[model samples]
Target chain A: MRELAKMVIVLTVLSSLSGGLLAMLREKTQDRIEQQVLEFVKGPAIRKILAGAANDPIADRFTLADGEAKRSFFVGKYDGKPDVVAFETFAGGYGGDVGLIVAVAVDTDQIVGVGVTTHNETPGVGAAVETDVGFIRQFTGLDIASGPKVTKDGGSINAISGATITSRAVCAAVGKAGDLYKRLKPEILKQLKTFSG
Target chain B: MAKTVTQEFVKGLWAEIPPFRLVLGLCPTLAVTKTVEDGIGMGVATGFVLVCSNLLISMLRNVIPSKVRIACYIIVVATFVTVVELLMQAFTYPLYLSLGIFIPLIVVNCIVLGRAEAFASKNKILPSIADGLGIGIGYTLSLAALGAVREVFGSGTFLGNPVFGPSFQPFTFMVQAPGAFVCLGLMLCLMNLAGKK
Candidate 1:
């Protein structure tokens, strides 16, 4: 009984110490991590899709409460006018989840451009989404209401060679983004006004 | 005593290297070696956790009851892993994203637990630190080497830059899942042949 008590006490103390240390570290690094996620992971894609914007889209971003989830939208301004918003959506792909950033011109309700933000898809195949800009560039000026699809599905966007599954996955993500844009259009517009000059 | 410490550190380099010799921690070995960048990043993170956990485990070895020792080691390992994860996400988000899921998975990394059970639980603080450093660095080097070979053959690029001209068609197969196994096997065979001499 004494031995068992000692073991239990030791385990409890060690666990408590571990938990306290981790909690403190998390608190210290929380903001810096969020900033890094904004600058590195999501920044390049937003900058690429919204290239002509006068302001830094990553810095001028906001989130909206959608049911239980908070959705972040990067605000892009062109000629000092806040007119574009880009956000991420995910789709199941060949290897894993493929992340796509869909940008829309708020005034035009048209996709400014679509960019690949994150993916674990097969390298040299599905990974072309990041390597091959032309594949993503096709989404520019696409009508969101039309619902973008691959050329095989009677849409204008061409599927990456030998990576049709990934291409379709990206299309699915874009389609989801379009739906989200429609659902959150009013909230997005209101958020954009706050960023506008 | 000094000789033993040196021995512990050096053994991890060639005699009992993870994935190569010990055949330990093969998951991260295969998963992160796609790029030299990711390989080094994971190796260093694993090393940090290993070193910190080993040091703490050694320090608390006597105080921790033998029956509950495993639980204490796990809590220690887990705490360090969380610290690494949060720090990486804060300072290096791109690397963090690429190494996603794997960071948290380090808690279960056999290397960390293996070292704690095999060496740290019985050793002094200085020796534990040495052991961790050796094993961690060895793991890092192996990943970096595998990453270099795979990236060169698979993509004809060295760290995302075109090492070969535009006409150089990449092997493409070298970066896939089977490619990782095949590459590691071939490298192991070479290591074995060299060891024989």
Candidate 2:
């Protein structure tokens, strides 16, 4: 019993020390990390999707509460008005979750663009969701109420060659984003005023 | 005694080159080496975890109880792996996204645990550090070589840029899952041939 107690104590101390050190490191790197993620990972997709916006959408971003989760929205300005809001959605894909950044023009209620932020679909097959711009362009000007779907499912959006599952995943992600936009339209419109050009 | 430290470091580069020589940590070796960028990123991250864990494990070698030592090593290694994961997510977000689940998977990498059990737990701090650096760098180089070969043949590109010009058709077989195994197998054969020489 005494030897067991000693062993437990040693393990506990080691664990505690490790935890404390990790906590300190995390606290120090938290902000820099958040900045880096925004700049490198999601920056390109947001920029591409909101190409014509005058304001830097990534910088002019805010988070909104939707039930238990907080979702981030990037505001893009056109003609000095914050008229577009871009947000991310994750949907089930062939290999894993496919992340899509969907941007909507507040005044038009039409999709500005859609871009794949993250995906694990097979390269040269399902991964075409990220590489094929023509497919992605089909999302532009889509009305939020219509809810986009791939052509195989009786919708207008055409699935990529040999990548029907990934194409469906992209549609699913956009569909989720459209739902979120509809549910949070009032909140999103109210918050848009804060992001002035 | 004078050259022992140098020997330890040099052995990792050639005689004990991981995946190729030691044949440990093959998961990351295969999964992330699809691109040179990913291969180097994964290698460097693994090296950081290895070096830090080795140093800590060696420093606490005498203090940790034998029964709970493996558990203790895991905690220390996990702490470092988390740190790397956070840092990578922040600064190298693209690489982080590409590497995906493999980043968290580093925690279970046998190389990290193997070194702690075989070397760090028995050696002094300096030798352990040397061992870690050598092994980590060797792993990095091996991954890079594999990544280069795969990328060049599979995509006809080097580091995502067209290396073979437009006329060169890519041999797509080298980039898929089957390609990783075939490439690794052929690499092992080459290493064996070289070792005999």
Query: Which candidate number maximizes TM-score?
Result: 2
Best model per lDDT: 2
Model 1 agreement with the true structure over A51-106: per-residue lDDT tens digits: 88898888899999878989999998888999889999999989888888889898
lDDT of 1: 0.89
lDDT score at residue B88, model 1, on the 0-100 scale: 91
Q: Single out the weakest 10-residue window by summed lDDT for candidate 1 chain B.
A: B1-10
Candidate 2, A90-139: lDDT as tens digits: 99999999999999999889999999987889977998888798999998
Candidate 1 residue runs with Cα over 4 Å from true position: A89-99, A118-187, B1-4, B14-21, B157-197
DockQ, all models: 0.73, 0.64
Give lDDT per model, in order. Answer: 0.89, 0.90
Q: In order, what fnat does every candidate score?
A: 0.98, 0.83
Displacement of the residue A127 alpha carbon in candidate 1, Å = 6.4
Error of 1 at A179 (Å): 5.1
Total residue pair clashes for candidate 1 = 0
